[model samples]
Target: MKILIAEYAGFCFGVKRAIETAYYEIEKNSGRKIYMLGEIIHNPQVISDLSKKGVNIIEEEELDKLTEGDKLIIRSHGVSKKLYDFLAKKGIEVIDVTCPFVKKVQDIVYEHYHKGYSIIIVGDRNHPEVRGVNGWCDDTAYVVNSIEEAHKLPKLEKACAVAQTTLIGRYWEDILEVIKLKVKDLVFFNTICDATQKRQGSAEQLSKKVDVMFVIGGKHSSNTQKLKKICEKNCKNTFHIEDAKELTLEMVKDREIIGITAGASTPDYVIEEVIKKIRFLKGEKEEE
Candidate 1:
């Protein structure tokens, strides 16, 4: 089958940097125990591959129990500064792999919080990145994903708003609009990364022309979920899969135009394999 791919899909700058850093940390700590604070970049395959290389993914609780000499690697989603300091106090080695984009947000939020503005974090409420952002302000920052929350802000005499890099584009705009009206003094930093914006735009554009769309990325990846949501709005035949193995042959048997797009955390080879399987099952001639 002729598969059209999104030009912007896969390994945004931040995720690429994070993954590269993790692998390098693994190599550097050879013959020594290396633990990842969380799945490095949300991709199960990537974490599984790291595990094969002796890198262990540990929970905060388990890591809390680790001895002073143990080494822990932070994921691309930056941890709260409090956690970093705590680890140092415990004499644990820390390898910070937080994305530069995330670090920038933390810096901005820290500055605004100290300046006496109530912080508003725009993103998923439970996402690690969002939680980390909230922790910067002692969890005083308001976390909201919809316009309703923005309108209900008890009061916004002075506020600073920031969005998670992988949020729905329009939702960010909507929240900003409402908050602008209610707050007497407001500042907003569009922290949404370019990679996410491009991917979301490309996914929507492809969905309009394709008969079936497959979104490939880690199940836990926020950006991947956003891409799928964008595609679903434009196409009914949208499927979100981490790998081709998760796709069934029957679903695309009748589809003539297939579109494949992956998330920032998805590797190129995984997308290639899914395209290969789709062509094989559909009995369509593969494009060179």
Candidate 2:
């Protein structure tokens, strides 16, 4: 059996920075209660490790119960302007670890919305990143995730658009084309993360050459799910698993070639474990 692992799999720059920031805060504020507004990143293994180290994940509804002296770490997905303001008003110390790429999109929406241009976000409506961007525009932005949604958008005189950092490039272009026809004036920024583009591109290419493909990441991770979807279109035997424990012999039996890729939030160790398991199942010696 031959195995091909993606050259760009696992943590990207932003996720690495965010995870490091969380650890730094934990070390610097010893004995203080540290709470993350949500999962520092999308990976379950990473979150579990952090929890064991005393980092707690707090939900939106739990915000009101927090008081002064509690440290809040903002997830990489960023938060809405309202959430930021509310946190400030509550007197909680906030450590913003929002990814720089996501911050750029928030700034763009804020600047253009104030200038009288309608804001259009090309991505999932419910995604935290898109919700954060919409918050800057006072929740007035139109969230379009499909060609059908873009076509249904009312004609506008002037509009400015940005994409969720993890959006697929082709889908973004498809939606943008329809919006261009409907709007008299349109300004669109392709905010999809560069790493995401490269990872998805590599996954698509590898899927075409492999008998089976594995996309490893958190089940709730948007980018991971996108990778799985892209791979499935090319390779019928695509599987999305969170870790090596989910691997089964039946899935790999008789497969001549296999490909593996992971989401931005996945850690190197988790990817290594999955690769090691695959090698073991195939009766191949592990790499040094």
Candidate 3:
């Protein structure tokens, strides 16, 4: 049996930076109360690790309980402008680790919304990133995750569209095409992160060549779910798993070529663990 991994698998630059910053903040503010706006990233293992280190997840309602001089770590998903204002008014220190790409989308939406253009978001409406982006437009943006949603939108004179960072590329394109027809003047920003595009591309290619594919990441992770969808289209035997334990020996035991890919939030150690587990199950020596 042979094992192949996608060239762009595991945590991307944004996620890696956020995780590193979270750890640094924990150490730097040892005496102060520290809270994360949300899960630092979607990976449970990483969140669990941070929790062990005294990083508690803070929800919107819980924000009021935080006192002045408290530190709130902004997760990579980011929070709305309203949340920022509230934090500032309360004199809370914010350690912002929002992915730069996501920040760009927020800026674009903020700028265009003030220019009399209707804002449209091509992404999951429920995603925290989408919610945060919508906040910039005063929650007036039309959020659509599919071509059908775009079709349902009322005709508009002018609009600006942005996508969730982890959205699938083809879905973004399809939604944009529909939005164009519904609006007289349309401006769309390709806010999908480059890392996301590369990861999806690599996963699709690897899936096509492998007998079995394993997509590793937290089950709730958006990018991980997208990777699983992309892989499933090319390889029917694809499995979406959060960790090595979720995978069983029988799944890949007889497969001649097994492929592994992970979401942007996945840790390198998690990927390595999966690889080692596979190798051990197959009675093969681990790589040095």
lDDT by residue for model 2 over 1-288, one digit each (tens)?
889997778899999999999999889988778999988899999999889889989999899889987899999999999998998898999999999999999999999999999999999999888888899999999999999999899999999989999998999988999999988989989999999999999999999999999999999999999999999999999999999999988889999899999999999899888889888777785544
lDDT of 1 by residue, 114-138 (tens): 9999999988989999988887887
| CA lDDT for candidate 3 | 0.92
lDDT top scorer: 2
Root mean square deviation (Cα) for candidate 2: 1.6
Candidate 3 error regions (>4 Å): 285-288
- The CA lDDT of each predicted structure is 0.87, 0.93, 0.92
Candidate number of the best TM-score: 3
- Weakest 10 consecutive residues, lDDT, candidate 1? 279-288
lDDT of 3 by residue, 174-228 (tens): 8899899999999889999999999999999999999999999998999999999
Model 1 spans > 4 angstroms off: 284-288
Q: Report the C-alpha displacement of residue 213, candidate 2, in angstroms.
A: 0.5
How should the candidates be ordered by lDDT, best one leading?
A: 2, 3, 1
Q: For model 3, give the RMSD to the true fold.
A: 1.5
RMSD of each: 2.0, 1.6, 1.5
